[model samples]
Target: MLARRLLIFSRQFVNFTPVIRRQFADSASQTKTVKFISGNKEFIGKGKVGDTLLDVVVNNDLDLDGFGACEGTLACCTCHVILNEKHFEREDRTNPAGEEELDLLDLAPEVSDRSRLGCQIKIMEDDPEVIEVRVPSVTKDQRSA
Candidate 1:
């Protein structure tokens, strides 16, 4: 009797394994495309398509103001933007912020848990269909006394 009960539990656990795996895989696949929305503007960046978000931002000449300040380099915090939660979760392809990037983020106003440097994020060959980010209005220096 104990052996039969153990077999039943094992079978149930095994049956649920694929369901759990599929959920994880689906979440990952859904994160490839990046869709950025700020204010009333909405922009979609095609992922796994050999084009970086910076490239799209510049090519399209996005209305965002901070780009002119950074020159697309990681030097300044002007390119600071907030990553949507879904994008934040799939940011694994991009390198994590270094000490310098983190320091710069500290100088960005409205910095939050999803803060990321626009220049640091790169498009990956197998990324999701969309990722969303939000640009803030002010930098820390801009709010100074």
Candidate 2:
């Protein structure tokens, strides 16, 4: 009986080992690093899967000027960012910006075809290890003005 019990325990342990390793692998891949460029200065931030671009900036204290003025409430365009065509296309395919976000982008100064709201952009598991975003040199906040 003891031998049979040990055999069962060993089987359970063997089955669990691969699951544990896979969990670690998934978590490692889920961490994403982002590069933020404002004017000539660049800042780097790291975030986990499901974290928004604004979350990465705020968590890392990136200090991008006039960023997140609406605290990611989507009421303003302070979190505007620009992504290259390739990255923008990938993100849009996975998580397209809603009409409200697009309307707000229309109000943002320096808007571009590649523009996205940092608050609306979240880090996905399949996203590249390093994502790059550009902050416009000047951001206009009509809400406060």
Instruction: Encode model 1's per-residue lDDT on 22-78: one tens digit a residue.
Output: 656666422245566766677665443334466557766666645637554456877
Backbone clashes, candidate 1: 12
- List the candidate 1 regions with Cα displacement exceeding 4 Å: 1-34, 44-50, 92-94, 138-145
Where model 2 places Cα greater than 4 Å from the true spot, the runs are 1-29, 139-145
**Candidate 2, 25-57: lDDT as tens digits:** 876636789999887889999997767899999
Least accurate 10 contiguous residues by lDDT in model 1 = 44-53
RMSD of each: 14.8, 13.4
| C-alpha TM-score for every candidate | 0.60, 0.73
List per-prediction Cα lDDT, in the order shown.
0.62, 0.81
